[model samples]
Target: MGLRSHEQLVVCVGVMFLLTVCITAFFFLPSGGADLYFREENTVHVRDAFIREELRRKEQEELRKKAEEAIPIPIPKPEIGAADDAEGRRIFVKQMIKFSWDGYRKYAWGENELRPNSRSGHSSSIFGYGKTGATIIDAIDTLYIVGLKEEYKDAREWISHFDFKEAAKGDLSVFETNIRFTGGLLSAYALTGDKMFLKKAEEVATVLLPAFDTPSGIPYSLIDLQTGRAKTYSWASGKAILSEYGSIQLEFDYLSNLTGNPVFAEKANKIRDVLTSMEKPEGLYPIYISMDNPPRWGQHLFSMGAMADSWYEYLLKQWISTGKTDDRTKREYEEAMFAMEKRMLFKSEPSNLWYFAKMNGNRVEHSFEHLACFCGGMAVLHSMNEPNRTISEHYLTLGKEIGHTCHESYSRSTTGIGPESFQFTSSIEAKTERRQDSYYILRPEVVETWFYLWRATKDEKYRQWAWDHVQNLEKYAKVNFFEPFLNSSPSYFQGAAGYSGIRNVYDSAPEQDDVQQSFLFAELFKYLYLIFSDDSVLSLDQWVFNTEAHPFRIRRP
Candidate 1:
């Protein structure tokens, strides 16, 4: 009662601080026997709560890791002033893509391909009998890479509404659909970080899954998307084509990685198990394989061409794509390559050019398809990743020799475009024997090899070779279609014509095939553009290209 007001306030603050300390000690710093007894009684509940909290934290962390894994590493855009004429050449290729895309948009719009000469749209059997816009799907990733924002945006809008369930009627080639549609969408998602493309890719893949429901898990060549029923090509005699089934793994495995779904990879891995278990004669797989529980080689013929090329291509690429953790793929790829070097590799007389010949039984056929020209690029790419210096050197040499031989196929031709197939007999070197083999379908293998070689070696000649192809394409393959519909476009676009295949590369003035294939935009122009781009853009270390030239990001462990 006699104390001043200030002294009374200080006394109250001291009492409150002491009370708070006493309360904290009572809950958290037990010391008395009675307090220890109460703590023991509740220990079980406390431990359980702590464990639950830890588990929840771990679950969150795992989800975070998966989300990070799904995020695509952005591809580097081409620098403005790259060395030498690289920027200029890249621009030329970009212009070519624009020209081709414009023609497709104007004529085909939503069709599979453009008949440039006829100025109309056409659908191929590979895509079934409907307007699935195969060209548009194939060109989306290309458009994004070349900075064609408006075109890419338009394609994305169409893709947003594309229904695989109602894509087409009758049989669709599982291989072609996987490569063009699934692969294209996957690559677009990888480059653009767009979930729309990924969703569409999963839809197509799910529809195609029934194709793998075979006794051997080897996919059928064709599947009716509507019916979900699959069957081998009638011409295949109820057997699966090696390339068709084998080439799909890259797409499916990649889909699984992006979606965190293991089923897609399991189905694809089953195909690998079947092929790996089957006995390959002379360590070489046949073009046709049985679809039984234990599959058998359907033919004695062996080739690195049309029916079998991409099988080997995928084997090597799958290993690389999976962050090189797939030792089985690497082993199989190495074994196949060793066998190919021993049995298929040959040198033509006089000209002394290297090539891979086909094998029928024990007989070696001195024949090569333009389709096999991709082997050179495959070799070079494999060499870069190889651990053995000697093997790597050998592959590099082999790649260059093969590249030169393929270039000869074009240089020897009158129109500077290679034919479908060629021979390497005593009298002939890179010359076609059959009239049917002389036609050029605007194939990209030769230029694809040049692009790979250039990237691997930085040799100027590869650039020159690719440039030569561009010049020839501009000269002979260009289709100048003038119509009132195109008048609204710029003056430069009027001169920028759509490209078509030639009836004969041997013709000084080759007749146009009238059709512009989807691959012209997908593989050909894309490869040409990449050839002139900086190495940092889509560097080989960070990505793996599927057989269709659609690049997938490397999935790291």
Candidate 2:
């Protein structure tokens, strides 16, 4: 191009000179830092860049460490207690299970339960849904968990052929199946990291989905595992047990996340949301809920017993399992627990023993059960989360009191085993009345709470209490054919005369029930064993136990 004037020509010549310099620099300059200024030494700049890089690298590493800490990591069981003490208890428990299993193997090998005392072996689907040896399935993970390798391997092999599709109809309780079967398999998978347990769990979940097909997302109380058919009671239209609908969330939600299926969590959350949405007095809902028609208020028959115990349990545990991410459940559980503190908790004036009182329309029912004793453990669990030191100590106190009261119930009995249910009337004679609800059946709640408190406090007294209970159970509940009973030869209960299922804890030689509930093996002895073993194995910090005594590891989100 030609310049218009001498002034423009001079500007063009200046620009050309600058271009020539830049071209020369582009060809000759170093690769990294030759953009703007040049013709100067850059030793300081290079040194500064290296210092900045190192600082940046360190900062990034620090940030990575913080991120990892921010994510919750579950604490695993740390070996606790004196080694000899732990081993002794473990061996005792192992033998107990073996002895109990002897009765089971002979009488109820493939059945859900054993009629230990029956002349000819009687089997029944008590809590487990199938006659395909649900007890074996229920006990399998427990065996593996406690390191009973031989038993674990045997049970695993036997269970490999379990045909889930062929499970019988007309003999299933949905609540029981959810707690025992689904919880068991899920727990086993978590421990073994084995996908087989997960696959079987998914099968059970698929079969049970039909129960939740109800209008309100609440499952029916019972279902046939084979047909996906529900057992309809006259009350089945909208009614469901409080704990049944509410407690399955921990197991089912974990399954959902593990399997990458949202359906499980969706249905479980439906129940949780609906239950908490109601206008409850404090946080306690009625023991029953009608899914189709929700009730706002004025139904106060409350207890932390069989029907409603695990609802509170799952709420707190759900908060934990999700790594404290579920704020809603936390709030719900706290509110409900405060309500129980106000309504259900009763400090006896005469006995001065703190016990949870069942309520009937704002009045004290003056009753608690072996099943309800689990609340003390829940209270101890909640204390760990409470930020306020004062409030936390108060909860711990409450838990210990309830736990102590439960143990007293057993100690007061002749057999030193608590009844299935007991009550302390507010009036004269505040002593526990087993006549209303007697019979131990090897129930595990009192001892279970005792174990929790022992772990939390490391108090030697709790260990002593645990020892006494174990000694009593061994003396009274253990079946010895050598002793012929003096009084009509101990009640041959359930028509089977089985050694398990004690009908009377108030007698020197208590009558034995025929039906040995599967949970005796699954929960009672398992808990006792854990209580005596070091608290590190299946520790409370690292695991959450379903109602059926299945342990699930706490995972970070």
Candidate 3:
């Protein structure tokens, strides 16, 4: 019995010794059992706890960064006041007149563009040209004889210098010259007692009227100025903006009004019809289209920029002027604008400055803001006759915000217009890592925005902003290139310049014409300043007109 008990005890002791050996190998061995045992016994729980705390802290930090980067935006409602419709109409007409006159004639106009072909390869002042037409139309429609005289003289001189034969098509100058000189002349004659501006305008109009001969019903971008025939297929839908197509229609209207010919209005309607057929299923207009056929997304490159908005403006204007009140085309145009406002025109930075963009469905393309676009919005607002309280207020705020942001961003000592320099990139999550390319242009757009804001708000800050723009232009952006005729005499100046910047950072080099157009930029602020500073001399008659002749609805949600 004692021997059996000892054997049992020895067996139990052997099992216990094996178990200890196995435990040792598992805890201490670098591979297999030892490593696994060590990890499970000594490190897993403690390491996991530390990791959990670290991850939580990291998450909190990320949240804080996101909060810091967010900028607040205001979405105000537009309010309409007492039968200010008449007053609003007068304000818009006058403002348009003043803006067109002051911005172009006082600063730019015959300055940057010397004698048509003599332009310093950079005289594509779309606003300057477009506004000239606007000035003529406003003067004629409002029956301002004195205004017509100044405008007609400028119109005639502008046309006298240009043959329009060698102008570049697909280039903006062709359209500008055609609109301003051609359309301006016709409108001037139609309104006042001057036939010189009118006769010359008719000749130019006859030259430009053939640009609408494309299969797509859209006008070709480039027309042989001499022959007045279109030759290219660029940005078909881009003309939808009133500024783009408006001058053309206005010209046609001028022709029709003067000659008592309905054919001009008929031609204008053809453009309207063409754009109506090109609307997307969602009503978003493409940035560009083929001048030869129906618009396709393949031809949709560069669709929604500042120029594109002008197309919309003109379309709506056409519908109203032709008594297309119940027209589906007019309604679609209105709807598209609403989409543009909701999706694209937003203040991404704390400054409340508006940015132009392409919308991909519900998303606003908060990529960049161009000068022409800011002006486009202001022009649209003026035309819509919406009370200046909200719509105008928003644009005015945007201008102020943009002015603040631009002064802050381009504060460096650099010459030449910063091509695509004045952009708000806070909305871009990967903006820091992105490179500046074609889309990132720094040009006259920033200062142009300042001009628009200053004009609209009449705030002293805008004048200060304009002064800052001028200081920058004088300090770093000045260029002294001589004209071909007088190489030593320096015959040309650039108000608005090129699309590229130094080292290709975010802008382009300074251009003579582009830089001179900045003078036009200066002229706007100066005029506004003079008007407000010494109101006794300036006439509001030049600025105000009735819009009841062409009434249209201005709605908001």
Candidate 4:
């Protein structure tokens, strides 16, 4: 039969067909999921049909392999092992808000943060923003997020008492103001339809306009809110953080659109115009850009970490916030995402753990940050805006996988909290190997990603995983103060478990970091609450959040 004679084989096969059937079944369908041929059919016509089906089967197998490689996570029907996680999440969110709100009122009312350990307030000089009383502004929407309407109303009124003209007498961060204050105000207005919040936005924007007086149209980082002068010690000192300049566009553009003034949009869009003219290697912008010299990139650091994370974020968000009308901004985002794909993605060679790597220049630094986890959520949001369905699904799968890696970062830790910074190595030096930054400042990026993934996939597994994060905070970082419990002070001792920051995640029983970032309320818990709630809350297509977790509708420009 191995004679170079197809005619002889075909003639013999038609006469005695069993031999042909056996050969075709063994060769064509050995490793397949389903059988391709029957026991009876073995003539040339049947042989031709089997060959065609087998070729089609092989082609499908190859395509499946490629798709699996592209998106490694399996999107099975979510495991529904527990029903109580949702109820627990709802209870947990409200309880934490009440506890934190009461703590702030007792100790640091009208101040930036509650020092849970010390029960006092001070200039959060560590952040260099110098603005006092930011937590209240940031926390207002979190109360609303959890549907604590009575608390939200009280907090809203409490905030109305602060006079911006006098409150302006501090060193202010352009990024923090645009996010926690301006973004917060706009979100409050959107949620409540209150004119007072809108009024506050106008007042704050009036004072904030001066920060853009720089020649490059990029705003300086710090300004004297009272004096209308930029601080020399901040970005005005011939340096600018890349994230600070790039992150403000969403809030500013929203302000411009709602109010019908060109100035807000004009100032913010110039940063994009400047970005358009510059040279970005591999389509990547460095961590610092000179606000003074728009052409000269500042630091050599290239990362999706803290200093550069939101630079990529606002690019994608700008197009969405503008009702998808801005193709120029959309193109800019697409180019940056191409760079993100090329430069930042990595898998740990030793452990098989997927993680995004930080970069110095063109080299992989093998570093990771809790802050960079926001990229997972941002990736999902980016995919939603994409026109190509196949690519969108693939990116969504990538986001789910990345979120899994971030969850692993927490679960692998003894303290059950993620590190502020960490790195992977190409060594099998230990079975579960990585180095970590010692502290956990209660950042929300990882949990925020969990929310986005769960919301997109409707996977209860993501919700369960986020509840693990909440329990970690409950076990390790929670703190409380009651007036009756510790009567040693000028004021009080009232004990309640408020969500607070930790000094270090590496310590099994670490000391509290004491300074709860405003974003804990603005971002972390809000996302957690939304993930566990019903599907209708902040639907993905209807709303998009600014960098600080302030939600905005996809408004027509």
Candidate 5:
């Protein structure tokens, strides 16, 4: 019995040992295996999260570096008057810009232009086919300068998705696209330090490069942005206009500098070399030049009004753009000014109003275009660089006289707005007799001159003249909400009203031309803002304005 009891106790002990082993296996071994698997999986996820964070941090640092590099040199703000009305004037201009932009946003939106009278959008041939957002591109810098943050942000977003390749249709004007798009983009980059604008500018400029594929390296007036095939306008007699090709250097050169690309500078410099090498008739460039292997002048026409205006303006501006180091450009500009003073510059009979007349051979046309009014500002700008006090004083005098004459053209008009073209005849001082020359297309040249004159001389008259022009524009050019019935149904026009061109600046009740040019935003409003603000806003010392009034940073030596 004792033996059986001992065997029973041993069996019980064995069973207890087996149960303990089972519990250890179930609770410890499987849990260890599961922990190993989960630890490995968690490590991978943590590594992935860490890598993503590192990449995001690196991207942010790169953007910060780019912004630092793009910041403009510190400019000392000028001391304004103690009780200056400049702020008041600036506010007025800002409101005008906002008004114009609001109208465009509501009615035109992505289209090239605004039909203010009709309260609709109109795409012109110059902006290619369809809606290219030309107005938006042109006004982006203006919006930024005026501190319209919301409007500026909207513009930037639209530009981020803008596809130039798709925007291309039919033929695009190389000059127009360069000045309004590429120039505008470059200006925005200079102002905002945003790389998106630089990218877009380079893209558009690449598309435009093929236009300079001619034997003489002279760019065609018009180019198919898609096909890259280029040709001159039929009206130009298969020759490129001087203003079209010559005016592109500022944009291209600025682009080349920004991107560190030699190609753009080479193309632009080639145009300059050709112009500098060519023999000028009476030291004045013709309005048209052929695109031949050895280019030839097209016509004997020389005018500072239309075909030949910006070319001369660019010569001086290019010098300033390159840190005033391009002595050749300066010399060429001086020679042209001397020749113009001798040949084209004249004074009207009784009023003695100074004007730059058109020259066909040796004969003077005795006519002035509102477009040529920009020459007054050009003269004022150049006078600052002239070393000779006598010549500088003469340029200043000429600039003031030109500014005065342009103001007279506006003040003498029945509507207090200048005509497209006016004559300096024995009887007529600044009146357009021809019906074709009677319209005013919201031009900024006259006021552009006033802005320059105001900056240079600080004469209250210049500001007053600009204010007068603005008042006239508001009274006559601003499209009235009641005018929707002039073209479309009132229900179709539900947005803000925009400024329209007057059929006749001389007519008290002139017909609306129903078009708002992109330049109204790019040039007129911009100039108005600059003239009213302190010179430090976009000081002439640190910046050079393109022909389109888009300011670019001057390369400092």
Candidate 6:
């Protein structure tokens, strides 16, 4: 009410000091002083975005977990069952070789009689399918997996009788000795851990490289081993290109790891580069291509069901092992695989399965009457990472269906079926349009398909299927039960009782279990045993082939 001049002056000075401090603080702050405050606000925005990303990742992890845990697959018992399958396969293989040897001995009785070709097991001379160039290679592949010490030495000696160098020079279109001996040599090395096997495998891979000399960078099916020249255009001419190509790469991959050989890696890449350029429109590849004329060969839009699986498998394996690939290659390959998966794997018959097709634009033109052995191979592709679980499951289901139906209808669920220790379950398809005529003679590939599917799904149904098949084999087919299953004692070895030719040997009503079992028999049964035996998939992670002899030694998580 009656402030003195000194009091009023004090209050005014206090207010003035407060205003001065605020002004000084605002002015001396950094140039982006407003932004500095706003930066704190930006964290709110970032937190929101980060939250969203985490949510998405969580969903993905859930999906992965669901995929991993989905369907409750039974772990395979590879170690325990491996010996059994290996033992069975070994017995079968021994019988096969002995039968051939006996035939060889018998041919001595006739004047100038030639033995069946050792490779293909085809001996037209004895009403046999004629010697196939691929037979010996397959046998050797199996032999390496299951051969005993003495057996391996004998195999080496027998193979030594043929001069592979000269045989490689003779014919290019027909199966060459190089691929044959390469498999044989590699198997030998794997079995014996010997240097000679490695040397021979390398030699074969070196000779096989010239096969990729085409303009398209895709390999020719046949190559002059002597001249390194390209040969004719057979259906599988270009298809055989990758097996040798990838096989060599696998060899090189092993060599690089084992011996630290940079040259082997370099050689593998050289072959890989040639094959890489064959990626075609819509990411699909051609079955045949001329090395010199990439554009001309490119026009023929042919894609076989089996060969397509081979291509994807090779690429996926390479990507997984070498990590040399990029996102683009994987994306392209995945797209191609999805496209093929939808067309061939889904819409194809529940009964007959996929027909070989031509990819014209987005559509396919059906060509073949019989399903090739590759449909089973296609089902195995489901083991990859992908979004569409239904697609993979559907194909796997269809494959099982085919196997079951075939077993019931064609083979009559017979056991111990196979010719010459091999099942001649050829791709049963008819030349005629009728279903009855559709039963063509071939080897039993369904057994292989079933085993692989069982491995992937680990469903009890597959195990039951396998169990039933095993029992059926023991029941109907010519099995020498007298030969004990155990391998520990010499008493288990029984004098060979199984015939080499197909079963239905002397019967008017023949079954499918007869004729020939391919080298793939070991692969089939090995997986079957592993699937049923409560083995872990992690055990098989490091294994490439998962065959009878090499049990999965990799540890599981």
lDDT of 4 by residue, 280-353 (tens): 87788887767565458865678888788898888888888888888888888878877777777777765566
Task: Give the TM-score of each candidate.
Answer: 0.83, 0.78, 0.52, 0.80, 0.83, 0.56
lDDT string, candidate 3, 1-557, tens digits: 35698899999999999999988866676565655777786787888889999997786565544543552211121222211332332233233334334334433343433211122323343432222333323223222432334554555555555443333233344355554455434534534446665566565666566666667655555555444555543344343333354335645654676667677668777766666666564556655444446644433323334546445545545454444443664676657766666656556555554455555545444555333344343343333333446755554554455455444444432332333424456653112223342232224344544444544556666555444443343334333221122123232222222112223323334333232232232223233233233233222212211111211121111
Report the Cα lDDT for candidate 5.
Answer: 0.87
**After superposition on all CA atoms, what RMSD does each candidate show versus the true structure?**
27.0, 29.5, 24.3, 30.2, 19.2, 32.2
**Cα RMSD for predicted model 4:** 30.2
Give per-residue CA lDDT, model 6, range 258-345, as digits (tens).
4455766676666566556555554456544444543323344535333333455445444444433344445655676666655544
What is candidate 4's CA lDDT for residue 380? 86
Off by over 4 Å in 5: 1-84, 482-495
Give Cα distance to truth, residue 552, candidate 4, Å. Answer: 1.2
* For model 4, the run of ten residues with the poorest summed lDDT: 72-81
| Candidate 2 lDDT trough over 10 residues, lowest sum | 489-498
Residues 157-238 of candidate 1 have per-residue lDDT tens digits of 9999999779678899999999999999999999989999999999988888888888889989898987888998898899
Candidate 2: tens digits of C-alpha lDDT, residues 274-381: 776677765677777664644333255788887788988998999988878899998988888888887777777677878777887777777778888898888887
Candidate 6 TM-score, C-alpha based? 0.56
C-alpha-based local distance difference test score of model 6: 0.44
Clashes of 1: 0
